[model samples]
Target: MKAIKSFSIGLIFFVVSSCGSLNPINPLSLLMGNSWALSSLMGKSLDLSQFADGVPSLNFLEGGKLAGFTGCNNLSGSFALEGSSIRLDPGAVTRKACPGTGEQDFLGALSKVGNLKIGKDKLTFLNGEEELMSFIPKED
Candidate 1:
């Protein structure tokens, strides 16, 4: 009885410790487990640090869904990726209007993204051959 109890506790511990691994592998799995923060937009190098509390990021989930912070409002949408080809459909996003925030510009760039390139520590989204946005992996 004591041995069984100890084994159960060990199993529970293992499960809890491996929770991070529960994320399934998908086409975007290579980009998963990382939050890519917006670094640049429309060829302009944005200084997001000056925004004080505004930090925008994109995270691709296991399914075809995506969740992101639009620098002002929260956003979630469906995405399709094949090889380097990608498309983002911003289906449902929060409509809270925060003046002076570049929410529209951010969403516009995201909608124009037709391809993705994952670098050593960065992620780049492109519209055709032109780079639309560049991102750096957020620290865990």
Candidate 2:
């Protein structure tokens, strides 16, 4: 009985120690601040700056709110974060037609995003397991 108790205690300690914690930045923190455009692609890298209308912009607010000019129309949407997964609620945009390959690409990429991964300097929007777009921080 004594040996069995010792083994159980050891096993418990090992199990507890082996488990890791999720230290992902609080989703609220991500939402409360601004995120800039780094790179974007649904299938290929598109010029992110062009979409900003010379604004160098990419920003997201709390509660999944997002906005930026894709060198065309302004885009915005509601987003949700669950653990490591993200869901972009159907986004809306201005109806004015944007002229340029960059605009078309930006529109395509935004429509496909289904998840998001935030890094210290980058936020990667993903569709399933593949990256759809990436955002970097701009100096204020």
Measured by lDDT, the strongest candidate is: 1
The alpha-carbon deviation from the true structure for residue 22 of candidate 2, after best TM-score superposition, in angstroms, is: 9.5
**Model 1 lDDT at residue 37:** 89
Candidate 2: how many backbone clashes?
Answer: 3
Give per-residue CA lDDT, model 1, range 5-123, as digits (tens).
99999999999999977955443766776888889888888856433338778888878888888777787887888988999887788877666547777888888899988865888
lDDT of the candidates, in the order given:
0.81, 0.67
Model 2 whole-model lDDT (C-alpha atoms): 0.67
- List where candidate 2 sits over 4 angstroms from the true fold: 1-24, 48-52, 55-57
